[model samples]
Target: MTQLTQNNGQIKNNYCVIDLETTGLDNLTDAIIEIAVIKFDLDGISETYQSFVNPGREIPPFISDLTGIFDKDVLVAPEFNSIIPKLKEFIGDSILIGHNVGFDVGFLREFGFNFEGTIFDTLDLSYVIHPTQLDYSLTGLSLF
Candidate 1:
């Protein structure tokens, strides 16, 4: 477990930065194809939770190219409902952070997890902290 500053600067304990790759952009229409969560200590990535999900929908061609995940690849994987318990266990009481956390958080919430924790958006934060910088994508930030 680790701690980080929240959106309001209050100390948030047990920080977990999460990311999700899905069938499509819409959480209502699509499903989580792959999920990655890396727990962070003060120094960096401490623990991780990553899995492929069988979305039960045909993977769109564009998405397959984007994430390198094909429908056949996850055909044998667990469904979203089946994996919620494990996801919850991994995220227990961690303050969640991500590039566009709402997307990942929204997906989790749709699967019936309350997801009670402080959320900090590095994307939104970057806009405030360094508006002059062009790209604030998670990969871009990692490069810097």
Candidate 2:
């Protein structure tokens, strides 16, 4: 990893930006159907990992419509447990950056992965930076 000094003089390189598509909105019950992680360093993207996760249950129709990740799409994919090790290694000592990151962190904790690092939430930051914006969602910010 290419180390770079932050404004505070902390040496760091990896910033793992993650996103997950789940079976539902309830973190306690829903399972992750898809996960994507992109590791960025000073030079740019150092690694990328993505996979369909077999949630072990049928994906609700509405979710399928939203994500295009149907039950059939993940039926042959690896389970969450199978990807934990690789996911951990990919995120090693990296700060996490995401939109609505608490939702993702909740699901990850439910899956037994303990994340102990700095988190940068774009959603919260957007609200502060663009207080008058009608929407602070990822799509909304992207459109702006």
Candidate 3:
């Protein structure tokens, strides 16, 4: 387990940044199609994992267009069940950081992964730190 620390109010190390590309927004109805995780420490990224998951359903046209991940792309990819163990191993007990972490956490919970570690949400933090900003979406924040 990696320990989380702060130096002069700045995050030090031992965090996992995760992102998921899903078929839709509804966690109960949608499915995860692609997932990526990068574990980083003070030195730099220590581990990285990424994979496309077969959602067992057709990817909606809008989602396919936005993500460039069509049904055909994941036709032979591993299922979510098969990916869970590896994901759990990669995350371990590191603090999780994501754009809108609650959404990701909801999807993971629906798939039966109980992530007990701390989570840092860039979306929520951005709202607090940049209250006047017009957008808090990941892309918006990135551009800002």
lDDT against the true structure, each candidate: 0.83, 0.89, 0.88
List model 2 lDDT by residue over 30-85, tens digit each: 99999999999878998999999999999999999999998889999999888999
lDDT of 3 by residue, 31-97 (tens): 9999999999878899999999999999999999999999999999999989889999999868899
Candidate 1 per-residue lDDT, tens place, 42-98, comes to 667778898898988899999999999998889998988888898888888778888
- Candidate 1 residue runs with Cα over 4 Å from true position: 1-13, 139-144
- For model 2, the stretches where C-alpha displacement exceeds 4 angstroms are 1-9
Candidate with better lDDT, 1 vs 2: 2
Q: Lowest-lDDT window of 10 residues in candidate 2? A: 1-10
Model 3 deviation from native, Cα RMSD in Å? 3.7
TM-score of every model versus the real structure: 0.85, 0.91, 0.90
